[model samples]
Target: MSSTPPPLPPHALDRLRAAVRLREAGDAESARSELLALSGTYPRDPGLAYQTAWAHDVLGREAAAVPFYETALAGADALGAEDRHGVYLGLGSTYRVLGRYAEAVATLEAGLAAHPGDGALTVFLAMARHNTGAHHEAMSALLTLLADTSGDPGVRAFRKAIAFYAEDLDRVETGD
Candidate 1:
């Protein structure tokens, strides 16, 4: 049996593109409706599920987006790498906004495991950590991320110190 999912039908692809265009044109409700209609026809399509979740998120319906995001992730093997990454980010962010910090952390951690060195996942993980009262760990992550990725001259000059402090924010240097 072929492990790969079948390619989406041409008509479905065209419709999906149209729905995306509607979203880009600021018609999120129409895009969501179109995506929902398409989903009824291709309920197992990861791309469709992801797009549907995105539409709900854009409309500030985080709770509504959860199941669609879960559906997309459940069939993640059918999604392209970028889409899979996006599903992780979106679902994790949605959970965080909904006050489900633990789920957010777990989802983002899983995403990082799959896509290591992803700045976005690391950043969201930090937020989730903060919400879960892991303040020191959250600060450490943010500081490390800033130190590693910053290009500002001032930040660049202090990168080494920032990295050192990130490992132990509470450690104080004693004058010998």
Candidate 2:
């Protein structure tokens, strides 16, 4: 038997695409239901798992999305390039929203390790840190990100650094 699997049916792909569009349009409940209906057929399709979780997350239902995100990560090979890392981001951010800041930190850190220099990971990591009341640590992490990204050609990092610093200055000035 061949090791390769056949391509997904066009109809199934279309359904997935439609679900994504529904989620983007803020009809996340419909999107989640649509994808949940397809889970048994595409058990290993990471995109399905990710999209299902995304709808839940977008609807502010983080707890429901957590397992789906974990499932998607457990079998991520079926995902596209952007989705492979995007799922990690979604999972980490969900954890943060749920007040599970430590899991958020670890998840985002793992994402950074897997996809080094990803700006999304850096930003989410900073957010997770801040949520955990580690403001200094968050700033340190962002500064490291700024240093790493600024060295790359044509990528602006100093602007972000300035923005963060400016926010801090304003907060301190207002005694917040």
Candidate 3:
């Protein structure tokens, strides 16, 4: 037999980290149960609440995530600026994934006004615009973002994504 390893069952911390991983690699159902249990223990912990919301989000449980995220945001009112930004980002992402494009745009725009150099928010706004058929504006925003000096990985990805969108739009219009 080959020397390949079998996958291990996820523990609480692994489940927690995987829950927030970008590609949805976690035991979200287990994460929800653990977080719900922890919520009773740490009822006032914004960090725990935020993780719970993120777990719900990754599990495609948008309705379940919203109130938890809102609670985290409210609890973060006295925290650092970065923490507050994170809250809006989570809310904006949840709304976007739920097809609430208008709310995504509005929330992300408000976050952008507060944190002007946020490439992540810019990409998110572009995605909302693209989903809402505002492709031209999306392309413009991505192109504008490409010109920024302090280039982040997300900005680079945004540029590439926008280029792809532009090509797709061309194909649609030209019937190619």
Candidate 4:
């Protein structure tokens, strides 16, 4: 008797892609439904777990998002650098939503320290600082990031927002 290997599941990858599409389209409900289904099929699929966590975050269910984000981070840690960066970003964003500003700042800062000069993590750290009322510090970080030629466009735009916040902080600080 010859042993035969099992064939890959048809359309599984496609379904995962569709779930990611739904996530990008801002359809958190649909994204969660599809990603949850995918997770059920592949319990060890970190991407699906990450996306599901993101969907929960988009739906304002921050509490529900934390554990999934943690799982994704753990899985990504052992997988690949890019995947690990993504999970760190997702976890930082989720912590920000949960009003866990300190954790968000720490997490994003750790990611930036690991991947130095990473504009995305810089932006996230700035946001975390801003959320925690560290406006001056946030603005300083944003300015540093914006001055870097390699900084991301999205982060540059966020720098502008932080500048505005910084201006407001200045006014308040000066009693103007």
TM-score winner among the candidates? 1
Candidate 3: tens digits of C-alpha lDDT, residues 64-161: 88887877766765446876687778888888888998888887788788788788888888888888888877777766666553367776657655
Which regions of candidate 2 deviate over 4 angstroms? 1-8, 146-176
RMSD of 4: 7.8
- Per-residue CA lDDT of model 4 for 20-100, tens digit only, reads 898788787998888787777766556666777888888888888788777676566453678678778889977997899
Name the best candidate (by lDDT): 1
Off by over 4 Å in 4: 1-12, 78-81, 133-136, 149-176
Clashing pairs in model 1, backbone N/Cα/C closer than 3 A: none
Candidate 3 backbone collisions, by pair: none
lDDT for each candidate structure = 0.94, 0.81, 0.71, 0.76
Report the alpha-carbon TM-score of model 3 versus the true structure.
Answer: 0.61
lDDT of 4 at 16: 75
In angstroms, how far off is 40's CA in candidate 2? Answer: 4.1
**Each prediction's number of clashing residue pairs:** 0, 0, 0, 0
| Residue 114 error, candidate 4, Å | 3.0
Candidate number that wins on lDDT, 1 or 4: 1
Which scores higher on lDDT, 2 or 3? 2
Q: In model 2, where is the ten-residue run with the lowest total lDDT?
A: 166-175
- How far out, in Å, is residue 24 in model 1? 1.6
For model 4 the TM-score comes to 0.67
Q: After superposition, how far is residue 64 of candidate 3 from its true place, in Å?
A: 1.8
Candidate 1 stretches greater than 4 Å from native: 1-6
TM-score of 1: 0.94
